[model samples]
Target: MLLEIDAQSQTPIYQQICNQLIIGIATNKLQPGEILPSVRQMADEIGVNMMTVSKAYTLLKNDGYILTDRRNGTMVAAKQSLDPPFQARFSRELELLLAEASIHQISETMIQEKIKQIYQKFE
Candidate 1:
């Protein structure tokens, strides 16, 4: 996995890792059963602290985006759930995003086009 981190970005290091892994899963760049690097190895590879990588992995596991087994190591999850509680949270986040875009005067057509382009990637 090649995860790019922007130290200057407002997002924290762990979140950048989490976001990239999620994107990898969404884009089919990472498949179910694909093993990921160990915390120490990933830390060295990305020049981040081991704890940072561990935090990211833990969050991903909790979010159902990845799994870890002692024998096989960490790997992507087979599927992500869309439970009702999670759906509500997802909707709220998306609504906030749209509101921000609207505040910036982003046209609805542009947002729809971008949404379609991104949604097609998961197909």
Candidate 2:
């Protein structure tokens, strides 16, 4: 897995690590069941304290993005359908998005068109 850290950013080091790892997983750059580097190894490679990497790993495990076992170390968790709390949180985020879209008089069609245009460009 590849990670880039901006030491100058306002975000905390641990949060940056966590966010990058989450994005990597979501993008399929880091596959499910793939083992992650150990905290001490990552900390040494990233030139950060072991506590920082440990914090990020703990947060990821707590959030169900990773699984940890004494023998297996840490690996990405299998993707599961969203639970009730996750579904509710997603709905809340969508509601906020719709509200913002309405503020600009944006319609569903406009959103779809923009998405298609961006998708084609990426392709």
> Which candidate number would show the highest TM-score if scored against the true structure?
1
Best by lDDT: 1
Estimate, for each residue in 11-111, the C-alpha lDDT of model 1 and write its tens digit: 99999999999989988899998999999999999999999999999999998899999999999998766799789989999999999999999999999
Q: List the global CA lDDT of all models.
A: 0.94, 0.88
The backbone clash count of each candidate, in order, is 0, 0
lDDT of 2 by residue, 1-123 (tens): 757889999999999999999878876788899999999888988889999999999999988999999899999998767799878987999789989998999998998898687556423
TM-score: model 1 vs. ground truth: 0.95
- In model 1, residue pairs whose N, Cα or C atoms come closer than 3 Å (at least 3 residues apart or on different chains), thus clashing, are none
What is the model-wide C-alpha lDDT for candidate 1?
A: 0.94
TM-score of 2: 0.75
TM values, all candidates: 0.95, 0.75
Those runs of model 1 whose alpha carbons end farther than 4 Å from true positions after fitting are: none
Cα misplacement distance, residue 111 of candidate 1 (Å): 1.1
Q: RMSD (Cα, Å) of candidate 2? A: 3.5
How many clashing residue pairs, candidate 2?
0
